[model samples]
Target: MSEGHENAGWRRLFGGDDLTFGTGFPLTGTRESRPDVDEEMRLAAHAEDLGFDALWARDVPLYWPRFGDAGQTFDPWTWLSHVAAHTDEVALGTASVVLPLRHPLHVAKSAASLDHLSGGRLVLGVATGDRDPEFDAFGLDHEARGARFREAVDCLRTVWSEEFPAASGEWGELDGDLDLVPKPTTETVPLLPTGRSRQSMEWLGDHGDGWLFYHLPDDTLDSYLDRWREAAGEKPYAMVVRTELADDPAADPEPRHQGYRAGSEWFVDYFRRLEEMGVDHVLVGADGDDPERGLTRLAETVVERV
Candidate 1:
């Protein structure tokens, strides 16, 4: 249950490789909270049962002004912990926790607690937050969040590892005499970066265990993978895609956000392309349908087929 133990377990299970085939947080229907947490988690459990490797949650507190959709529509840590209680095998992750807005201790505590509760199944994706309004609300500097993020990462690791770890930074002071309690199951949880986050791709690849982002065209995907490979020295890559299922297997895909609106046939083929492109995982966002019916059909057609 300690952070070191969790890190060790993470290394033991994952072996520092990418895990493929996960379900992204659903965003179907209105955000007025009709779809309860249990309903959302049942969908995730189905994903796990169908051999999907992971489930992800998104972190967006108050629906930022410019950002159109409110992601996942829950408090992310609470959601993850709730989902963790329900599922057995699937890895639980945040697409990217907006680290700058939160105190690192809280983030570390919550993430480590989830890891312990889930038996070392937490993958902590972090980002230097981009929403200016959020930073303003937190009294944090968006311009300097990148530096703060790095410091937070370092701080989290230190607090997890050493008893009474010391850190000197503008963010705060952890005078070498205070260490975090109930450490993560692993010494270090899998720290993945979302997008560039103001750091160079090399910096990300060098420091992060993996990367998460929305889908891009093949050319862009390849370019980004190439950069990751070069900097990572064989680190893995990951991404999420939006998807909608149709009744027909051969239904042509219409353009959705970062992915296409496609049928099962196109869906399977998309995964193939992702695999060929060296993507380690694709967390499909099953938005806009009856959650059970939608996921069931996809499992039968796309997930089972391929």
Candidate 2:
């Protein structure tokens, strides 16, 4: 909650009440092989050209085949840094980082470095992590994630804002002698806790700079927004929408995994509805065989129209 104005990324994406658009990585997703880094980068540039507000990266440490989905297939920090170098003004973000699995100092250092690298264009979406197998692999207790998440949040805030900050937690103790350098462009990097992250709504309101949530139904979202606004006043709320655009501009929509398959017209109206409901930003994951095509169409019809 102590970031926005000093961070251009936060201002651009979360400043206005009208919903802004951003695209997640893996522009064209892969099935059995790794995604094409070259082409993905190409689309990233094109996305900025198309006026996309932000470029989001996913954090998938190890791909589990049973999950049936490999995330962007890249480490979020390195990947975003690469993305930062390639683009000019477009914001850079993490859809959500698994805080319990990584050290808070590492996260703080990486995020601060990236923020400086990107001209303060980083909005770190953090989570407690959902995959159970990941916890076992990392030698962590699954049930203790909530506590770990809180610790990480505190650690990051402390190290970034205070010089030689002292802290002790599940990760490790940071003695008051050594300090983290290359402090973020702001008092601290903007952190938006994603999903529930094993945390209560009240806690999110208190700590988060903002909130990042997955796709939700209209009725459900409205209800959730009611709760969110009451708890968090003026703090921005962002959500993802999985969409597959159709060739026909007026084509109807059908439910997909966490979103819908629809034409530009419907997508426009859907976004308008979200904007009206007080949604700040919408991270659109182009869901289909050819993501660039869907992206182009969305930019033309939905983004422009909105």
Please give the clash total of every predicted structure, in order: 11, 1
Model 2 Cα lDDT, one tens digit per residue, 131-206: 8999999999989999999999999999999999888887888789899998999888988999988899999988
TM-score of each: 0.89, 0.96
Error of 2 at 93 (Å): 0.6
What residue pairs clash in candidate 2, if any at all? 1-209
Candidate 1 residues 227-256, lDDT tens each? 888888655577878778877779998887
Q: Which stretches in model 1 have alpha-carbon errors above 4 Å?
A: 1-19, 27-34
